[model samples]
Target: MAPAITLAAEAPKLSSANTGFMLICSALVLLMTPGLAFFYGGMVRVKSTLNMLMMSFISMGIVTILWVLYGFSLAFGEHNSLIGWNSDWFGLSHIGLTELWPGYSIPVFVFMVFQMMFAIITPALISGALADRVKFSAWSLFIALWVTIVYVPVAHWVWGADGWAFKLGVIDFAGGTAVHINAGAAALGVILVIGKRVGFKKDPMRPHSLPWVMLGAGLLWFGWFGFNAGSWLGNDDGVGALMFVNTQVATAAAMLAWLAYEKIRHGAFTTLGAASGAVAGLVAITPSGGAVSPLGAIAVGAIAGVACAAAVGLKFRFGYDDSLDVVGVHMVGGIIGSLLIGFFATGKGQSAATGVFYGDHTFTQLWKQCAGVGAVLAYSLVVSAVLAFLLDKTIGMRVSEDEEISGIDQAEHAETAYDFSGAGGGVVGSVSASALATAAQTKKVDA
Candidate 1:
């Protein structure tokens, strides 16, 4: 019957250095989800901080399970033009230890986990937009479904072996299109369906903790080294090193530009502006880091900082409450970064594709970048809106008006981020009490 069940030879030799580097990068990327939780958490009103944090934290759990079950297969398995569906790796059942991914330096398992980190953060990015109003149960359900439907397929389109964009020579060194643009569009879609947050423009709704915001932004910046440079899957190459430098350069430039814009427009260089600018820079440079020079990264970052700072106000002009500017920063920055590649790519880095500015005036690469961006944006928006609409109709997506006014953290999780009722009369006690007391007073005022 069986001619001695011959196993196929392993794909290639495993590079220990590459494997170890990837392992570190995977851990660093994993840290971004928690960093995102804190970042989003710090931006919301104190009443909903935990809920904001939970919305991001839950994605790490949900997407991890889904990735092991079938997400990996659908995303990176054997492929068609749309998506792969190989069952051989489902539940990670048959991946042999020490097995190398084909033509890659890292082991299959290490590669799997690295990709898994990407999957986790992509959905977490959406939580910033829905912020205070979403039902925790419905939000959790949305993460599972959205990642499966929108993220998986779009990931396949961009990164899978047979994905249409990958095959078309689209150069997404990281995930400007797949992750940022995808999540950004999804955020916009859900907010449109869910409508504005209760106090559309009248409420202050200012961040309760700029210190927390700064801390979270710092962590995100630290983790992004892994997010951008590690996409090369190995630190042994010059491409990875180039990307690492670009990540730093772009982020710093973006921060400066954002501060300047804020100073010019709002007449103040706020701490919040610095933090938001840095993230915009990170998002803008993600797709282009491997292909552009440090100078190019600065340009991208500067433009993104200016553009996103302005775009944030669109919520008021057109009335869609993207609570934390996910649509503005991630989506808009992603589009700018992706499109800029067609003008900045030197055809000298990891990607051999030249942009219009690099003596290639045909704009061929530019059009491909647009297609990649447009496809992900359209699919993610439509699918996310449909999911939100359905969830709103069935299980109800938003919390009750009373719950929202009171504080989603207490309403949903029965926990507060800070408790002042049991503390001593030190500075910590005084600050916590004042913050909580002020929050309670505000709730009373709203009531």
Candidate 2:
């Protein structure tokens, strides 16, 4: 019989290399939240840019506090099959600094903070779907509650040692199901409750700034190296290196495929399309990178890129306003990544299960993947819808119509993303121009 897993009882010697690597990786993952902010913010119209950015930024602050309090405990600590808890880790008390997590080289605190970054970003991903319409206060409250109720349990299920999916032999290398799918489903549910954005298909709601989008995408790509590779928890493992290489390959392939699709479908290949494709690739490869070969990564990326590009249009046909294609890119991409594992997983490396494509035709792993995806999708959607409904009835979920059209930036935050007043020049230059025009008019009248 396999030896039973046990906690690290002895004071294990700290590996400086592993600790430093994780610390760096943790910083990289944290950077993705702001990267997400810029990505979502740029996709929004100028009127709603600040609000979009704030939604992502707020998660950083809110989830960090929650994670420290009990989020970490509920996710990683010992508990029942569904969830986990340890009062000792509350506020990170009693846990010794020198102690390592079970079967890991890194310290418990490092892992806590690393996972904490994941918690912060998942709810933020949902905000993109409800952009331009959601009330800031309502969003803040939702983040706090959703992370506790929805995110915590789901994190446990996928990542926790005793969680059902983890125990059931599901292989989510990172967060294809938990983070992306969960956020995507939640976004869909909340939007269904809140209804469509005011303009829907009628308005020309093009992204205000593609440069910002490119920059954000760039940051996300850079940070994802850590997000995917760092999940290995130690740099010494060869798997981490493979994951890192696969991440880049899949993302690149996905971007190219998306561009090709855009060229074929539309007359021109747009920059925005390329950026979105890259993100789709990133999302698709995230869960599969650890298990799949480089060739598999390419396949995953290319498929995700094309699929998500197609899926984004569903909002228009279906009459739901997923403002920034969160459902398309995150939800659909996540599912693609998760399910593809059933076909592409080699069973030769880090993940020991053989996919059907590799001659394991029982489809056992496929069913497990489906279960993880279905469970997360169903739970997140139901809970998010309920939360949105309750908040709508009580505190009002959306801004007033006037607030939305006139500019959510000013109405919600009393500020705008850009200051156009001095754009013609400085304030003095505008004043001087006005004075010159007045003088010319006066002289004309005298003549």
C-alpha lDDT values of all predictions: 0.90, 0.90
- Find the number of clashing residue pairs for candidate 2: 0
lDDT of 2 by residue, 40-59 (tens): 89999999999999999999
Off by over 4 Å in 1: 1-12, 424-447
Clashes of each: 0, 0
**Residue 21 CA displacement from its true place in model 1, Å:** 0.2
Positional deviation of 428 in candidate 2, in angstroms?
9.9
Candidate 2: C-alpha RMSD to true structure equals: 3.5
Question: How does residue 112 of candidate 1 score in lDDT?
Answer: 89
Error of 2 at 308 (Å): 0.5
Which candidate comes out best when scored by lDDT?
Answer: 2
